[model samples]
Target chain A: MSPLAAFGTALTALRVNALRSFLAMLGVIIGVAAVITTVSISQGAKRAIEEQISSLGANALMIRPNSSSRGGRRGGFGSGTPFSDADTIALRDLPYLAGASGTIGASGTLVVDGINWPSDVEGVDADYFDIRDIIIEDGRAFTQAETEARARVVLLGKTVERELFPYGGAIGSSVRINNIPFDVIGLIASSGQSSGGRDRDDIVYAPVSTVRSRLSGFRYPGVRDPVNAIWVEVRQGYDVETVTAQLTDFMTAQRNLRIGQEADFVVSNFADFIRARNESEKMFSVMLAAVAGVCLLVGGIGIMNIMLVSVTERTREIGLRLAVGARPRDIRNQFLVEAIVLCLAGGLFGLAFGAAGAYGVEKIGEFAVSIEPMVALIAVGASSLVGIIFGFYPAHRASQLNPIDALRYE
Target chain B: MGALIQARDLRRTYRMGGMDVHALSGVTLDIEAGAYVAVMGASGSGKSTFMNMLGALDQPSSGQLIINDIALHERSADELAAFRNQTIGFVFQQFNLLARTTALDNVGLPLLYSGMATKERHARAAHCLEMVGLGDRMDHHPSQLSGGQQQRVAIARALANNPRILLADEPTGALDSRTTQDVMAIFDQLNREGITLIIVTHEDEVGAHARRQIIFRDGHVLEDRR
Candidate 1:
């Protein structure tokens, strides 16, 4: 018989017991839906974390003084010998060092048009904006001349800009930090929230010299114009860990410490931290995939069971067909086609269900999810493959039945 | 004219409980075209076994069985199936009509396996149903039809592929006497139209309708008369 005719016969058979056919397809539907939903959710989470990590600058590393221990008295972190402008400039000439900038920051209340809002204030060199990937949305960044002149010009982050100038016009406006008036020269673009849910846009930036000289701050021992931390940008194609080791060595030698002695500074790479997070997310995705795969396997087994039952129940019908000259291959094709069509139908429904499930997860679970067309295609293809694999044995059994015996089957 | 069916020294044996049970042994027969024949025997007398051999549903252990000039014994199982499609029509005592299907589609079942196009298959099925006096009940399912009407649908299904020989294993066995006469009348009419008929039954009244009768006893033909 032609394949089209075989398909028609299978369809009619399925239609005769529509409810049973749907029940047979339930397992496959749930399986494919689970695969799509889990993959999309995990993929969305990975992308979100990557974006957050990239916001911190992929090639950048932060260096800060470690906690100090002197005479059995331990001090908090960033209490050791702080970095200065000269120390940052010294690191700029190192191999693969793209830029170096010393940063000092303090939190204080800002008063703009009598609206008081508390936020952090940071003093940085001109290259700090590039190292930290901070973009100026409204006005230009302060130049080297401004830093040398200790200009009282400042840049407001998105959150501070929105709060201090709710009706706009924050740029070129004067804001008082620590009761000292400073002009807002630029508005920093939003960097969104961190993975830890911290609001990254609630800060302001000013020249390092301006903040060191104007803003009151304690200085480290014997350090001229001390800064709390130094941010370094490594050139493209350079490894952050290698540069970090070189920086630590340079700092150790600058401090006149022995070769094996531990440095008094700590260097943190954002890439390493995010890599650990990505690994965990990948593990979570793999676990969910395994569960979904098991669901699909169970679904395939369900189809096989149902098809076998169908063959048994229709034994007499099979006998009648064989008597009417149906080839064994014809009988096999009819049952096999029934299975494939059943799974393909389930796959289409599962795609719809998975999309709805993904949307539901994104809304209720507050997760990012997306369904790719390729994923949908593969899901359908996988269900059909499952049908072929599981449906074979029962179909073969039906085809091998003795015509006379099958006719006599009760 | 050459005989339409020829069998020589036909023997069929079964291995049951590690013992041989001979269903047919050293039997021989010949049937001409358009012949109306009945094979009769008591239970376990081998009439049904001989009928199964005649219908090509089972192969004889030792025999020269030829139908329509084709040596059925030498053919493969698949080839026998094809030969049956082209040459034999079968009607069982149970009618063997597909449940949940219309009479028309049930009649077209054979045509479907023969690879006839759907439209042509349906047309031929309709014609066969009309010939069997079931043309008006084409759309009725087997459950919706009476015993006699269901038998008529089965007969029409058997005729769908225009087979040269009709094989019925107790066609009227499951019907009331009244329905039996009605089904037998259709068989007579089909044989009158030159389609060879072979019916298996133990009832003398049913066998009386055939022009030829053969009786079996203990796996051998005890009587053959015209």
Candidate 2:
């Protein structure tokens, strides 16, 4: 029979058993939906990470003191001898360095107009804003003169601004940090949430010199200029790995570490962290897709089972067609077409279901989930393939039936 | 007219539990065009096997069978299918109309394999249904039709490809006496139109309606008369 006519016949047969057909298609529907949903969510997470990494300054690097060993119990990172201000100056002088700044932070309470709020107090040099890509929303960043003169000027993060001056005039206001009064020179723009799930805008920024000499009133024993960490930004088109290697070598030599001694510092690149996160996320997506594939396989098996049952149930009908001069191939085509139609229909429904599922996840779970058009297309294609692969055996069995026996079947 | 069907020493054997069962043994016959032949036999007499060979639904085990000048043994299965589609029409005891389908579609089924366009297929199917006196009931499904009407729809389907022969296996077996007569009358009218008719029946009254009768016993023909 003509392919179109066979397809029509198949459709009629399926329509006659609408409930069974839908039951057979259910597996495929759920399988495709799961695949799309998982891929969308993973992709959304990857994108979010990428945005966070860029916000953290794509070319920025954090240099922390290595762990310190005392009585064989090693302290965590940044527990070794802190870097000196001379080290920051030396790193800033590197030809490939775009900017560098030193930082020290401690948790403290800020009070303005008797409204006290607990927040992190971070001390940084003038170049910290440029190195971290921090945009000032209200007032200007700390000037070089302010940093050199140890001015008690500070920058308020969005969260601190909102908490201290809810009515909006926080810039140029005097806020006391740990009972030390400082002028809020600028309001930092909001940067959403950090990858660690911490609020990014819940800290305060002040000059590192003032924080070390005035606020703390303490210094590392025998150390002239000590700082907790150094933030560095590399110039465009510069290799961060090469710059990191140079910085490591320079720091090791400057610290007088012997060849057998381990360096007392670590240079961590934000890009490397982003790459690692993406790799893990990709692995997670692949695992989810594999699970979805198993679902599709089960769905395909269900289709095959139903098709076999249908073939057996309609043996007499098949025999009648054969008696009326239908070729074996025609019979095969009819059943195969029925299977593909079921799967394709299921796939279309699954696309809608998956989109709804992704949207639901984003809304309810508050997670990222983006459904790309290509993913939907691939899902449909995969479902069609599943149909053909699983539908063939039953259709072949139907085609090979002896007409005499089939007609004689009760 | 030339012989429309010729069988030379046809035999059919079946293997059941590893023992050979001879269904058709050494049967030879020639049927001319426009002939109305009734095949009659008791149970296990091989009448059905002979009919299957004549309709190209089964191959003879050890003989030659030709229909419409084409040697059946020389054709491939697919070619035989095509030959059957173009050359023979079949009607069964149970009517065999596809349920839930309109009479028009049931009748058009054979034409679907004929590579006919949809419009032409429907037109020819409608014409055959009209010929079988089911023109007004073309839109009715099999469940909505009576026993006799369903039989007529099957006959229309058998006639859709305008084949050279109509093969009916107990065409009136499922009908009442009045309906049997009505179906037989349609067959008689079709025979008058110069289409060959082959009917298989055990009922003497049903066999009597044909112009020729062949009787089988012990897998061999016992009587042949016209």
Candidate 3:
């Protein structure tokens, strides 16, 4: 028999048992659908995070207490005071600096009227919102004059505003932070969640000057008291590495640290931080792909099992055909055609299912989701390959039957 | 009648439960062209084994088996398949028509296997159906036809290949009296047209219809008479 005849035979046999064939294809449908949805959603998440990280500005540099590995015992810059308050001033005085701010973190429950919400209070000098892409929703951030004068003012994040004063006015209300009453000066717009899904709006703000002088008592000796962490905004085109290097050298000289001894500060580049986040997302994608791969493998085995049972059921028919002059090759082609047709049909349906799955996810998220045509094509091709590979043994058995014994089989 | 088949010392041993069981034991036979022969045997006798060997569906354990002067045992398995298609036609007791296919396609199957183009395959298939008295029933499936009609379609397929030998394995076993007579008449006419035929059956009336009779007991031939 020619290949077409063999194929026609296979197609007819499959059609005869439509329900069983469809059930066999179900494994493929679920497998491909899962692969498409997982890849699209994960890549979507990765893209969102990368976009958020880039919003921090590539040239922005941060100098923390000390690298976490060294227990924050100042090593990369200036003395052993971790981040002294003078590091912020010294970094600001550099020629390439456009602006600078320092942050000290503290958490407290804000009480306005009868409302109480847990909030993160970031002690920042002026230019914090501008440098960090934080938008003020209601009015304005504390002015340089107010920050310098150590005013008792606050800005509510969008979620924080909802929690503390959802019904009415919060701008003029007073909320106590660490039992220290502060005036609500402004509100920050919803920055959505961070790349890590933390709520950006769950925060309150206070002046770094006050945090250093009174509210906070954590200190390392050596610079105008001490600071928690400092971030220097470099010129738009200046490299963070060059500025970090210059600041580190100047800080070392000022604090008088030995060549091999640990300094009190650690400098990190913005580009490196974003790269680390992206690497984490890539690792996550690999893990998802591995899981999806295992599912497809099981689907392949299911195809093989069904096809083998079909071959055994049709053994007599195969023998009769052979007795009537079908060559061994014709017999082989007949069974193979059944398997290939099965998988190819499964693959097409799987593509449709995967497409619909992706569309559903996109509609729910209301964001862009990518469906790679090449990935679907590869999936279809793999299914066909799987059909052939899994179907080979049974088809061979069908082809090798003795025509005489087969004819007499009852 | 011309000599169409010749055989000598044909032996077929079947392994039953990992032990050798001889199904055909040293039997020699000759069948002439256009002769209608009946092979009679009870269950487990060597008669059906002889039929299989003649149909080229099985190889003899030891023997010289020839069909139309061509040695079957010397031929490759594929060559035997081609030989069977070209030389021997079979009619099973079950009628053995592909159940879902139309009567026309069923008759044309041999030609389809012969690589006939679709138009020619359908044309020749129609012709074969008409010859089987199924001209008006060409498109009907086997399930839609009577047992007698289905057997006729099987005969049409057997004739389409224009084989030298027609082997019927209890062709009327499932038929009633009327359909059996109708089928027997068709076989009679085909034999008159000089097509060699062999029928394997236990029915004495069926055996009486053939010109020659060979009876079997166990794995050996007991009697041969003409």
Looking at chain B only, the TM-scores across the models are 0.98, 0.97, 0.96
TM values, all candidates: 0.90, 0.84, 0.71
Give the clash count for each candidate.
0, 0, 3
Evaluated against the true chain A, what TM-score does chain A of model 1 have? 0.89
What is candidate 3's lDDT per residue for A90-149, written digit by digit as tens? 777778888778888777787877667877888897767777777777877888788777
- The list of candidate 3 runs beyond 4 A from truth reads A49-247, A250-266, A365-368, B1-3
What ranking emerges by TM-score with the best candidate at the front?
Answer: 1, 2, 3
User: After superposing candidate 2, which stretches have Cα over 4 Å from the reference?
Assistant: A65-85, A95-98, A104-193, A196-228, A234-246, A252-266, A277-281
Looking at model 2, give its docking quality level. Answer: medium
TM-score of chain A of each: 0.89, 0.82, 0.66
Better of 2 and 3 by DockQ: 2
TM-score for model 3? 0.71
The regions of model 1 sitting more than 4 angstroms off are A70-75, A106-122, A134-139, A152-190, A199-204, A211-221, A348-357
State each model's C-alpha RMSD to the native: 3.1, 4.3, 8.3
lDDT of residue A345 for candidate 3: 85
The candidate that achieves the highest TM-score relative to the unseen native structure: 1
lDDT of 3 at A123: 87
DockQ (Cα-based) per candidate? Answer: 0.72, 0.59, 0.42
Q: Which ten residues in a row have the lowest lDDT in candidate 1 chain B?
A: B77-86
